[model samples]
Target chain A: MVFTETGTEIALHAGTSCSSGTCGAGIAQNPVQSLTPEDQRMLAAFRPETVEAAVKKTIETYKLFSYTDKILVACSGGKDSTVILHMLKKFGYAIEAITVNAHIGCYTDENLRNLREMCAKIDVKLHEISFRKEFGKSLCYIQSILKAKGYDYKNCHTCGVLRRYLLNKYSKPLHPDVIVTGHNLDDEAQAVMMNLFRGNLQVCARIGPKTGMVHDSKTDHNSATKKKFVQRVKPLYFVRESDVVKYSKLHNFPVYYGECPCSSDTYRREMKDMFKSFGEQRDEVKEHIIKSFISISEPLKAHFMQAEGGAIQECLICGEPSSKDICNTCALLAKLRDNKIIKS
Target chain B: MVFTETGTEIALHAGTSCSSGTCGAGIAQNPVQSLTPEDQRMLAAFRPETVEAAVKKTIETYKLFSYTDKILVACSGGKDSTVILHMLKKFGYAIEAITVNAHIGCYTDENLRNLREMCAKIDVKLHEISFRKEFGKSLCYIQSILKAKGYDYKNCHTCGVLRRYLLNKYSKPLHPDVIVTGHNLDDEAQAVMMNLFRGNLQVCARIGPKTGMVHDSKTDHNSATKKKFVQRVKPLYFVRESDVVKYSKLHNFPVYYGECPCSSDTYRREMKDMFKSFGEQRDEVKEHIIKSFISISEPLKAHFMQAEGGAIQECLICGEPSSKDICNTCALLAKLRDNKIIKS
Candidate 1:
């Protein structure tokens, strides 16, 4: 299963049987093709010499590297991450899988079970992290506690922040240069929209293939510092959500076929609905938005980095690049602890 | 306990009291002195010669009246609504109170309980509804279900939307010429900031003292139009949140003193924090925002009335203005019912 930008179609070309070793028809190949106008545009816009060329380009841009840099794909075992992992492996990059089983009391264990099976098939090392083990808390318990405390954000926010925290802290010993995430085009576009909506140009600058404040030289401190914030990359930054879904389907990829358990009460859904109302105008308007963002973001990005006194302080609890005396992850854990939630 | 906008120093002199006297120092028998500097200025500016004069000079110019006919107050049995009601009553206008209790969730019960006690004290009549009574679901239940459905907005958004829906629909049968709400300067200004942050000019137009939407000749349907989105008025439009808080405390008025159960999420809270860091600059900024809003809104309000097709067909289930066959509220409730929600 493969995806391309500027086009809506996913080409699922099955590998020939090891014994046959030829690309002619009936060597046991199932070639599924999706050809749509959306696909056509995506392909043309994000054109590459080959899938390998695209892969190498993404790796260099996202810095998914290793001196033994050991790239850990923070896979939900979802289509985007799976595709990312598969491509990285194809390019012969050192890689492993990290799955955070943030349960919503539904489909989580099942997804993890499926992910384990996929790891076995791929013969790659897969690491699993569970909220239950770390906090002795299930999704329900944490949700109830947060609700009780009048914590503001929706459930998905909690799941996301906690997942990023756990993935980073747990993977620290391995010292991976990159944590390859599965953020796709729609996700990137939404962040940009959200940031703009709130007049948060800093957030717009802070998110992307090379996200975060690099206080070591990278900019703004009053706003979201890229250095303090983790740098994130989207290998599928140009891939549409639809293509990923289709590719996963056609390839029989063991992906988590569900929405993020906590995303139901957010404005992004509102934006999606508004975006959908545009019909054929949707992609064009969205692309227009993205292109506008590219230009709008550059000066601010450089401006933020050059601002003085912007430094990443070491976290007191954990030696991560932090803006405060302690990092957000450690602060959150401390909050959890203060609430007696460490063993919830 | 009283409030006068004359900018006097609230002299508690042992002098003659006016008609219907409730005096603190003494029932003053002497004639009152002439107006102070601020009072003279206001008298010169407002020139409240008659009801029409008052309406035209102060109210109309500032948009205090949406309709010259009926009065409908969104009451919480709090000082804000109570004061609006009291003033409307003094002005010899028809008026009533609409209160939608969000089932209190134990905490809110205390608020409503206090409100009811105060209403009893003031002899202010209240028409009461609750999330449980009307929708057969607690906010908690609705929230959990919506969360499950992959919806994600700030919790306040859901609460605000539901309250608006209920208030508007219930006000439909009363057939008031205008719906009067206790939205003071703070609420209006905060909302304006929120809209601008989100790049939503349309929604911002829907707020303020005399919500200019009713006069938009283009889509200006009558208050009794099937959509039931009547005009909203705020007598306390110029009152600051701090002033309101101070007035309520000074008068020993019955008021809900806590924050909304779900407001500390999203960009508004962030804005609030940003303003807090700026101290009184918030008030200056708010005044500036509201001034700008009025300038833009006056013409937009006229255009809004003239605009057509803003309200689509009424929801079949609820008979409310809806874009689809059903409204988002009714649709959400239906989902809840399908999930066996008790109230829905």
Candidate 2:
């Protein structure tokens, strides 16, 4: 267990005082006393101070948010996002949280409860959106119908694209400066590997600390035009997933621990497993991969971006920003509708 | 077992009447009748027809060697090089073989014996180089002394650099147009991964099918100079190591199957294992990685080569063309001599 100098000072300053557990800025309540030696070491390495330091570094490096900016954290009641939300609040940042409830039965209810509990504890506002309310069908039903039609789409893929579409669509009204995500180093590294494996070098432009451009067909494609993209930020972009898990456990947040029921064998999962196994041998492999990716991403973008000279266009069906006439989300929905699975 | 349309014709034309087992042109006797079904399948995929087609394609793509040029096969009595030597011979190309006897006890004897037998059968000239004759001590002696000095250099690393240095140095008198190596897809892909892990993008320029430009310090660094590098080529660049093994065994080549006595765990070996594991899930992963490597090699070369404008220098000690004043081999030898591990 290692602690930064500041972390050690905080631990020493708060020796068994402040029972509310909020006084020790980044020091936990010595939860190490109850854990096995191995787990204790793991938890100690993930001390709030270390994780917080990484988050702070990422935020500063990417210029994620300012105190005056409206920061909207896309909370899924998962350990990553929950930790991010808690850390931002601890840092005295003005932040709001939003959760898209796909209404996956009891799981959805539990996730909502977790979000509400954390929001109440931090005295922050929580916004809940439902798939049925926004799209008139549960995600489970949509996936099932698509599967029955032999569409053979992955549930996580469908869920992720639709969820991002909803988050972006709904956040426009909120007028937030940035949409913060809980993407950690493991997630980002896995995503980079996935893109490499799929030979999608152009997609690398959408990675990095602060990425995703607003390619609005409604406006001129000229650089002078002010882009309206609500830049997404990942404060936990440098922290490892294991560290986040340890931090979550140390804080004892009521975040949902269950995996999504629709999640199954996937390429992402395979890459994640490969990374974890490699991590066991070389601790900095994930960091190295991400570093290598960043070094080449710009050059790769320069080489590939020129090939993609076509300006963004509006999806004919949904009138959303897209490279093609139909947005990816609308295309999937169209497939579902063609099979009489859903109505507009 | 699968058979290429042309492969079956080649196999049938030879029949079982070739007493010396050398009459069949790139066709092996049906040893499949005695093997297990799985082994049969493996060997079927390594059919000489497929391997030959790959060789032909690589030669055409890289313009490796012409009919009039002399070719040197750097055969370490290994399966890859022996197979290459035989394949080129079967194709009616004028070829010579060279083996480096590093004097690692019985292993060296066996390697030399295998080379002699193959050379005798094919009636190709074989050149044997000895470490003790050239360097005044066996490789084992220098490595042991270096290990005592706490240098802790890997045996394979030392052997590889020294062998390449000797090959390039000795082949000058013969004036071979191209030095052919037995590197297959597996070796190339593993090398690419190793470079990525080390964050050595500059080293990537020395990769690909036909790589390594001779930059003479005495001449202009510009491209017009017709640099006097004996270009290296890998005819089996697209074949997998496993397929090479199968091909070697199917033809009953008396190649030494033993690994180098001092082989150590390395990043390359780890990558090879990773690739093999992935191969279990997707057989085309090795091919994909090689393709990915080739796609980026040019861009990587363009980005890095300009930064390396310094022309190759004559090694002050050995008078060989090198990137530095003193070549890598001379540097190692200097260290050995400094430690009294070698004598002038």
Candidate 3:
């Protein structure tokens, strides 16, 4: 896959082929890419049995999902998501895949193609959504319009708000029991630290393997009021990012190794870098952080829930599940429309 | 003063003289040392009026102490402690000073001399204690003995345990209402992060401008049960370390700029460096962390106190205040005695 400098132009290219060149004619071939020395070292140290066991254990421990439940995997064509997808399929869980084509140049194009190929190979259904189709403009175009109109939001901020909105809106039709994402231990740890550093303790309460506010004893899980938002779970919550990469490489899974081209989230990046440097000195620092977070998550959730009155409201503008009268998506869209950056 | 490589030998010389060389003979002479370029820049940017107001505000807001209260300042001859001690004296708070001579080579020797000179200049009574006089050996000697006996404790650990024990024991006779330390914002932030990172939420609860577990609603502050440990407070709790350095340099306080020679607390050093780097990108990151910590500290302290039974115990051996049956100092001394490193 190739990306333009501005990430505004899409470049079409042939798909990656199996580099090992040893798959039989009848078998579904995977794109086996060359591994860097570091990748090779990690791959050598990767214990597939142990990693598989850990993933399964996390799923079981968290009661993430059952084999009978319909699981929708949020695939970004990244190593983490792709590994989880394949693992779930191999474990015989009824699953489907979904991807967002944010029109981020050739990046999303290649990711979407890889998603299609992997889903087809695994005999799972794939759902694709695009910003241009849904919002009448590519993500880059909307970002440019917002920038031209003096809105100073970062690319990741806009992308995250829109992508999350689309994921929830589009997945509602599928009626899956739970939506699964490929967030790993490192990602979860970063989220915990970022929320704390930003002084967003209430937000911190709404994160874990199963994301959301803690349910009070008074709230009924099966009540009609709780059905607006689909629950999200993470099976790979215990797996490290490096381990995911190593597992993906070991399995010759076609995945993108680079970060999002337009990602300018310096704070999160700094946190990631900090963890990397700290992890070098101490093994399982990320694990320690996540474990510590889990220990306090209950009280954190309870305190914040009580403080905020613990009600999930429907966005007045879009009727989506929100913590406020208007959801972040509807709010951002309103700003864009007010400035004539997007159609009303 | 100079510290040797092993930090086991003292090489003291004459005291620092005022570098500006403009002090009139009758005035108390301050050892005005040469400032680094960075220090000069900080000094130039230092707003003495604003800083003094902030310190005064923090004291009044926290009710740290009053003019009528007897304040015992923990003077280490470092920039932080020296500044706080001087500030308290200048503010007309009834204050005395105390120092712990750990005998960390020429480091403590120079600090001791500086402390004496500063106290004499300010007309505050000074009390001094030493490891050699109290424990029959210098700090280095004890650390060496522990190392030789395969105790594997870090120098900072041993020094901290012994120094804290000595401070509480020696300060008892002074009968001060509160013991004041020069803990700045950066130090408190680091302590918060370190405790959280180490999963010691209980320890984090025991820290703030006024350090201790939260007093339960039923417990009376005036009760004899709470009198075992002297209440410790920090007037410089909201001030940044850089500002403290600038304030110290601006006043030409005879303070040591370097860290302790025997310091090997890498975890804390890393936290400090992390804050420095983060501070470069975003101003007041430390303040944010500290403010957020304060918001949750009450719950943290209350929860931990309830879980731990909320009782301060008298050390079985030393009759000192401790959370455990035996104080850390008594336990360490026992270890040393058992190994024949110290007399029983």
lDDT of 1 by residue, A9-82 (tens): 23232222222122222201222343346645554444333433655665676564544666778887666887
Ordered list by DockQ, greatest first:
3, 2, 1
lDDT of 1 by residue, B1-344 (tens): 12134422232221233222321222112212323465344444332233224323445666555345777778765556755665566566666677887643434554576567656765656678888678665565566567766876457767766787788768888887777776767777767655544444445445556652354444434434434467666667766665555444444455545554445565566556544543555676566557555644444333333342453244566544343577676776566567664342
Instruction: Return whichever of 1 and 2 wins on TM-score.
Output: 2
Cα deviation of B139, candidate 3, in Å: 2.8
Between candidates 2 and 3, the one scoring higher on lDDT is: 3
Q: Candidate 2, overall lDDT?
A: 0.69
Tell me the spans in candidate 3 whose CA falls farther than 4 Å from its real position. A1-41, A212-228, A281-283, A309-330, A339-344, B1-45, B212-228, B281-283, B305-331, B339-344
Candidate 2, residues A1-344, lDDT tens digits: the string is: 12243422121212233223322232233534445678667766566797788888888887777889999999998899999999999999889998898755555556677789889998989888877687666666566657666877887877876687678777878998888899998889788666655554446545678865544452334533224346788888888888888888788787655565556547787776666556464447777767766766555555554444643344565444445667677788678667754454
DockQ: the better of candidates 2 and 3: 3
Candidate 3 residue lDDT tens string, B116-182:
8889999999999988788766776677667767787878778877777789888998898899998
TM-score, chain A, per candidate? 0.72, 0.78, 0.82
Q: Is candidate 2 or candidate 3 better by TM-score?
A: 3
What tens-digit string does per-residue lDDT give for candidate 2 at B1-344?
A: 12243422121212223223322232223434445678677766666778788888888897888888899999988799999999899988889988777766555555577779889999999988878677766666666657767887777778876787678778879888888999998888777666665655445545667754544353334444234447788889888777788888788787656565456446666675666556464347667666765766555555544444533344565544445677677788678678765454
Global lDDT of each model? Answer: 0.57, 0.69, 0.73
* Each candidate's DockQ: 0.02, 0.26, 0.47
Comparing 1 and 2 on lDDT, the stronger one: 2
What's the true lDDT of residue B211 in model 3? Answer: 67
Q: Order the numbered candidates by lDDT, best leading.
A: 3, 2, 1
